[model samples]
Target chain A: MSLETPLHRVEGLGSSHSGVSHFWRERVSGAALIPLGIWFAVSILGLAGGHYVSVLTFFSRPLNGILMAAFVVISLYHLVLGLQMVIDDYVHSPGGKVVLMLAARAFALACGALSLYALLEIARVF
Target chain B: MADNPQRPGHRPRPLSPHLMHYRPTPTMISSITHRITGVGLGLGMAVLAWWLFAAARGPEPFALFLSLAITPLGQVILFGFAWALSYHLLAGIRHLVWDLGYGFDPRSANRWSLVIFTLSFLAPAGLFVLAYTGNGGYYL
Candidate 1:
């Protein structure tokens, strides 16, 4: 028989199967944040001189609402992944690391929910 | 050959490098700041989540939240959060440009990094001023 084995056998059987890809994913998220971040900044800046009602109206626009929702989701996802890396690096205790990661995920999810709710409210107001 | 460094009984010990011996570069510092802002953003999101939930709850909770936010400590935290958000956002953009096979040159990278640093603080400060004063009162 040849020395080479089946691809599945070489792929590894456990959680470590896709570990390398996770690092690349974190970088990819980081890259995405750049334009998203600038867009958010410019959008907020445009609202600077407006009143509360005007600000509300701006978000009330369908496109604006959609963009805002996208921003919220993307920002939270990036934040969670970034925070997870931080926890993994510093929280050496296994239990503490797991707890911290879970907490980070929960916080991100809460932010996402609140942002979506706020966007929906804006849509209703319009 | 018998003279080889590899020995049957003696396992080679890995050499650990000293951090102090390494030279730091702009890329290294940028990477570090990216991480710092990331953590800041996480904490900032917690504060923001609280604000959103409070606002959704009712006027009373919002008023309570507003009161807390107007305090000196609250303002500082908010200001810091704003900067953190801006920095992370700008830095993320820089990374995106680099990833797209653009702005990879040393000069352009440094220039963009400087722009990100300046805009991060400037955008947030401008927003705070508008938010603070445009509400007709000192705090909003």
Candidate 2:
């Protein structure tokens, strides 16, 4: 008896396919955000009442600085994805939705890049 | 009369379900809350990133941010943003728990959801009160 090959194997997978792409991306980003988010909350809490120099000193630590940069980038990317979904659901006009989603994504990337740059400067790595 | 009024050969039309007909489940409510908080966090994070950038720039920019933050309207917005941040963070951890193949039991899920919701709002509110009362510092 000959064994039947799995569907994907027989299909000879290439680079592209469709279905639930956005859903799973959001879920994975959501999962990563949990730990990144906890670290963020704790870090911010530690900075309570800290003045400018104090805050700078706190971020000057290499590990803390790196984590902050990662957290900001990841969180901002995740935020844009989540907001895009919300806009898609609520905004009925196609043109408006596309414009808004693009704007949201651009804003997120800009924020992420700026935050990362600031963290790097604080770390003296820039 | 058409032979295909309910013909097996014909494809069925898609029928969207009515929300009012079905009772909402714990999972459904939690999912909705997650999305709501997710959106809230999106806006909150934007503000936070802006705050950080301002601080990184110099005292002038930081003071500009602080002036807005110190205003009554700004205080309310900050409070709401904090609540959103806390809620989204807690709820997200709850989601991670579910993702790890635990907390699927209905009772536990419901209990945890309530716990997350309560703690999310209360923790931030408590801190805000403490700050406002000068127990921590003058946040207002």
Candidate 3:
């Protein structure tokens, strides 16, 4: 019943006549996050109360390192988008909202960079 | 009632549905709490990123983070973060379901709102229980 390709964003034919790009992208990233979130959560739980050696050894694996990097990237992408929407809806002051959005983006980027550095350092990829 | 001069509690109001004009339903509260928990999780990500960055720095820094993290305050914060992340995940799933054009009826929507809250709390509490009970000693 649809003519558009899977590549195209949906909801472009309504009365508003615009695509739901933000909503679409958010959902896509969120769908991807389910497994990543589960992996991180359960793995963290397993490491619970363990010592530094255990933690280091866990991250030393190449697969864990790669998954950690993927997790950080997707999470930061989702985080920035979610924060932008939150600020846009709630912040009444124009200038303040813009500043907050920029700050949120900066925070996500920082988190992403730090996470990658740590994972790579643990794996001795550098 | 506000549109009629003779009606009681009459007052001018915006044409659109104003937030203050309605009673707070579970769905409404859940919608807002989704954002609140989201912001909480965002802040929690700072802690996570710090943990990773510290680990990369050295064992000394890693131990320093652990020293602080095992403290009462830090444990509390971490617990809150866990709860917030679980809550957001459940809430996000609910939103995704709605996006797929299901659970739109008021009855189902409200039920889902409560379900999300209940499961969100329960899931983390269960995980924390298992986490803290490992090997009759510190598991982390």
Candidate 4:
């Protein structure tokens, strides 16, 4: 009385034949962002209106450098993944979706790389 | 009524239901805001990238970026970015909780939505007050 093939039943995959990797990754990143985001906000807010030396000195701190680099990488990755989901949801045309997805992904990667480079440069880690 | 030149056996794609017909609810608003804030944050990343690059570039570029960032229009943009960040963080937590199979009930979901909506505004405002009242004008 069932229509599903044996392979399908055994695989237990959805219509897209994919597991919950997307959902899991999004949630994991989201959770990580909470603490990291708070720290970032505090650091930046404190540095606001400060002199150039102050800003550089802040990043020169090893802990701040490490946290900032981590925050940048994770947040950009999360941003791209979330944008991918949103574009997939709303964009009707396959071509349009592909364009948006690639743009977002490339933007995220470029930003992430640039940010980490800046952090390393500030820390004088080369 | 079939056109002679039209392609045969093509099927129209299914569409998502229209949005206007449904009553607006907190859950719906939260869902929409989630997407909006995600976009806002995505856009804000450009500013962050620029700030970092300027810092790496040295004093003059950093000064340029800092001056632009402190202008009134820049402050407004920063406030909006901060609010978006706060809202997204709270809502993201709510989502993570839901993903764990809790808060699906109408009441809890609505409660979380309302809480997030209020705190998103208050958090940034509180930080502004704290920053300005402390020593120098550092309220971001």
- Please state the CAPRI-style docking class of candidate 3: acceptable
Candidates' RMSD to native = 6.4, 6.1, 5.5, 4.7
Task: Using DockQ as the measure, name the better of candidate 1 and candidate 4.
Answer: 4
lDDT of 4 by residue, B1-140 (tens): 22235446876444445677688889999999999999999889889988988989888998899788878998889889989999999999888888789999999899889999999999888777766676333432
Task: State the DockQ, from 0 to 1, for candidate 4.
Answer: 0.48
TM-score of each: 0.69, 0.73, 0.84, 0.87
- Residues A12-118, model 4: lDDT tens digits: 88677776778778888889999999998888778766578777888888998899988888999899889988898889889999899989988998888888889
- Residue ranges of candidate 2 with Cα displaced over 4 Å: A1-24, A87-97, A124-126, B1-28, B129-140
Query: Which pairs clash (backbone N, Cα, C closer than 3 Å) in model 2?
Result: none
Candidate 4's TM-score reads 0.87
Rank list by lDDT: 4, 3, 2, 1
Model 4 docking category: acceptable
Question: Residues A1-126, candidate 1, lDDT per residue (tens digit)?
Answer: 755468746775445666466667777766666666666666755654333455556667898778777777877887877787788777888999888888888888888888688768757855
Candidate 1 CA-lDDT value: 0.71
Per-residue lDDT, model 2, residue A29, is 76
A44-97, model 2: which lDDT tens digit per residue? 655655466766777778887888887787787788878877897779889999
DockQ of 3: 0.45
lDDT of 2 by residue, B43-138 (tens): 776787777777678778877887888789988997887777777777777776777799989989888878887897898888676666655522
